[model samples]
Target: MFTYERKVTYSEVASDAMADVAQIVRYFQDCSTMQSESLGMGIDFLAQHSHVWMLTAWQIQVMRRPRYFEEIVTGTWAYGFDSIYGYRNFLLKSSRGEILAVANSIWILANTKTGKPERLTGEMVQGYGSEEKYPMVYAPRRIALPKTWEDLEPFEVRRSDLDTNNHVNNARYIDMALEYADPGVNIYQLRVEYKKAARYKDKIWPRIHRENNKLTVALCDKDQKVYVAVEIATDEN
Candidate 1:
């Protein structure tokens, strides 16, 4: 089947300075669409495929926020297939093909009732979309991770961290934004943009700088490519 693709919108951007992690997650939530497609792709093998696609984990990185009606391409294709699970990679890019974000996920097919995965069947394996280019690459859109985090500090997000998606699972920006913390100070305020999706297991480092109650934070790859810019508010109490 053809890979799913589309542009992005303003609503998809994270704007509130006091926004919660779950709010930041809406930017990448296509649950209904992705769910339908995922199961649909299971084809006749879904029930008998032996293996199931469970959301074992994910590594996601977003570079910058997409403007309303921004011409972006969202693509999802198989990254790799194992006997027990299938690894997939996703990308969001500018119309010009500039990659804005990259994400990888592992899924397993298992008995829904028993929660046990079975080996992938030939048909189950064949039905998946084509293998993604650079299947092993962790982050294709990002340049090298940040060389170093010169300054680090403490921070926090509160009830605001809870969003419509319910929990911060809408994405993991809250955790990403907090990465820069030294555990020396308590976080009082946080504001971050949703440049990309922070899927399960995506390791994000928060680079921090502070002036009294004002804090600046940026989310980056392991190498530390600053992707999301953050603003913080603190009372120092």
Candidate 2:
């Protein structure tokens, strides 16, 4: 288990001064990157080897939201890897060691030059300590969509949204979806499934559905091809 400490910055919080869901997503993303970097398989390392990691799915359970200036510890481990995919799990805890959130993610290692998935190397597998275990377990697959959806405002992918991969960073998709979310809802859990990459100049169509305390949002292109699907559960009865 690789762990890192961080103080929730004022800018990381939303209007309530609680760390936003997107901010937690960013922490999870960074923790995984830092974990791999510790093993010498980070972005720069992999890029030098002509490879990049693409997030495919995410499942996060937020027990409690951390507030501004709160010191938190985030840790992640690569549970295992297959021919083309990697499995990871993460945990967020307060300074007192109380668990705040847990997450599961799936990623694929692709070749930059060919854009094809590259097989896992023995070192890469061993370096992450595949045997490290965590209690949270979820299938890393696409979330099923409903037959219909209510369209929300559309958003354009801005230049700042792009990462080193030239696609919108994974966390940015959550931010976009949340922009259309019901402000009254207090999300306790969220699941994000990334279907395709959206880049600069791409316009994303957002749609939302609220069923009691649960909310579902999906992002698609003008052509109706789905990009990211988000399911959220709020703290209401």
Candidate 3:
């Protein structure tokens, strides 16, 4: 596993002075990206080969949110790869060595030109070695939609929401879904399934459903087809 240490900045924290869930997700994302970059299979390399790694799903569990200015360590490592799909795990820990969060993610190597999944090359497998999967109850990549949904106001995608790939950044979907979540609820688990990429100026029709301590938000298009499905579980669950 590759690890890096840093202090949480004010920008990464919520009003409560604790790191926001989205920021926690960002930490995990960065750890994986840094690992890929170090392995000579980063963004530049993928772009040069007309390939890109598309994040298909994320399952993260937050044990505790570190406070502002708190030093923490973030790490990630590949656990497996199958066909065109890759599996990775991430961890965030406090300076005291307490695990703050852990995550499992799925990614697909795709041909940017044709938008089709590409098989992993031999060099790709050797570059980044695999490890045992993180010890956590793994959830399915696909989240089941509720029978009914409460439609909310539509949101137009902004330039800021676009990532280097010109698609809505994975973390941005979490930020958008949280807008419909209960502010008082302490989210302990988050799962996001990215169905399709949303480009700038696309209108997102959000719908929410609440059952007990679990809240789900589906960001969709006008036709009601989902772009991203976010499932949040509070401690009460």
Candidate 4:
């Protein structure tokens, strides 16, 4: 497992002075990236080898959102790898060691040039040894979409939304989906399934469904084919 400590900044918090769910996910993402960089398998190394790790799904559960300026620790570890797929887990904790959030993620190793999945070799994962999966009720990688939803105003993907892969960042999809969520609802769990990469200038037609405390958003193209699907569970029903 790899861990890092940092204080929540104003920019990472919501109006309620608590860290936003998207920011929590960012901390987890950054921790994993930092671990890869330390293991000599960072972004530069992957790019040089024409390889990229594509995030296929995420399951995050928030116990409590840390307040602004609160110091916290974020940790992550690779739990397993099979063929071209990798399974990892993440945790966010307060300074006192209370778990704020935990996450399980799935990634696919793919050839950047050919867009083909690459099988994991011994050398490829030698540095990052597998560890036990986090203690959480793991959600499936696939999120079931509702048959009906209300369409919202579509928006174009901006350059700022792109990460090093030149497509929408994984966490950005959560940020977009939250725009259609109830402001009063405090999300307890979040799950995302990325179907396709939304590139710069691609218009995303958001379709939302609300059932009690749960909210689902499907970010899609004009044809309704999804780019990403997000499901949110709040505290209240």
Candidate 5:
């Protein structure tokens, strides 16, 4: 029913000079993930029902991503819905409330075995605040397969990538893999698994593959172990 906002901080950026999408994903993910829990229809709730939410798709628009340390307000609330997907809207705004970026996401609560989303329960639906607005996206109109970027000779894991537990941030790996593919500006759906962890000073190689509209991005370590694997699906605007 309401949205939240925050300023853009340096720790959220990929580099000092620009506001990278990776940081944006971090900010958005944190907000959306929490919103899911607040409504009692997210992770914790799904746990009781024997399901996990997967991000099947996303739509993003960058009107004006803020520069480093710029104050911004980030807002998120449940919006629209369809038969199988729930639509969540997120917005980034200036301290004065000017919109900076907008994102629409599609998620499913699936049965782990069948991998199909069951219709959301009445309670779950109401909890998410999906009442009036419902935005529909044509998911069948898929993203074309992107050419794989088979080399990752330049990227390196910095100390900051590690968290308090001394593991690379799960989300950052998804960003690194997608960046190597350079699969155009519009990145929509991403499905990834955190197979293993890579530490600081580790040389990383990104392996990319595409089939139809789905792109597979994987980050491998010096030992050729897969630390991260992501499937990118999109329809370029």
Candidate 6:
């Protein structure tokens, strides 16, 4: 496992004074990069080798929300890899060791020039050192959308939403999903499956399905191609 520490900054807080959901996603991004960098597969290393990794899906469960100004320890480890995907897990813990959240994710490596999935090299797999443990296990590829749902106003992607990939960042998709869920609901779990990349000026229609404490969301384009699908399980409190 690899570990890193970070403090929740004012800019990362939401109106409720808790760290924004997307901020947690950013932490995950940082930890994943840092961990991989240590094992010789950092962004620069991969770019030099003509490959880049893309997140395919996520399953995150929050036990307690981290507040603004809190210093937290974040950790991640790769548990396994297969033909085209690497399975990893992460944790967010308070200074005193309380788990704030835990997540499991799937990632795929692609050839930068071809944009096609590639199998991991033997050396790369050995370097990551599979740990075979998890905080959660989830359906990695699909997030089922309900048959009946309502669509919200379409969102236009701005320059600020794009990342180094020149497309909508994965965290931004989670933020868009959160914006469409019930405000009073405290989300305990959030699962997102990224289907396509959304670039600047792309307009996405957010569709929502709510039943009891469970919510489902899909961000799509004018042609109804889903960019991302989300599943949120909330607690009454």
| Candidate 2 RMSD to the real structure | 1.7
Q: Which tens-of-lDDT digit does each residue in 1-237 have in candidate 4?
A: 899999999989999998888999999999999999988999999999999999999999999999999999999999999999999999999999999999999999999999999998687778889999987888889999999899889999999999999999999999999888878678989999999999999999999998888999999999999999999998623
- Candidate lDDT scores, in order, read 0.49, 0.86, 0.93, 0.92, 0.64, 0.87
List where candidate 4 sits over 4 angstroms from the true fold. Answer: 235-237
Off by over 4 Å in 1: 4-7, 16-39, 42-52, 132-237
lDDT of candidate 6 over 5-41, digit per residue (tens): 8788888888888886678888998999998888778
Off by over 4 Å in 5: 112-116, 131-141, 146-170, 181-237
On the 0 to 100 scale, the lDDT of residue 237 in model 2 is 31
Question: Per-residue lDDT for 196 in model 2?
Answer: 85
Q: Model 2, residue 159: what's the lDDT?
A: 96
| TM-score for each predicted model, relative to the true structure | 0.49, 0.94, 0.98, 0.98, 0.62, 0.95
Candidate order by TM-score, decreasing, is: 3, 4, 6, 2, 5, 1
Query: Residue 64 deviation, candidate 2, in Å?
Result: 0.6
Best by TM-score: 3
Question: Highest lDDT: which candidate?
Answer: 3
For each of the candidates, give the backbone clash count. Answer: 21, 0, 0, 0, 8, 0
RMSD of candidates 1 onward, in order: 11.2, 1.7, 0.9, 1.2, 6.7, 1.7
Give the deviation of candidate 1 from the true structure as CA RMSD.
Answer: 11.2
What is the overall TM-score of model 3 with all chains considered together? 0.98
Clash pairs, candidate 3, are none
Displacement of the residue 224 alpha carbon in candidate 3, Å = 0.4
* Residue 203 lDDT (model 5): 76
Candidate 2 local Cα displacement, residue 186, angstroms:
1.7
Prediction 3 global C-alpha lDDT = 0.93
Error of 3 at 127 (Å): 0.8
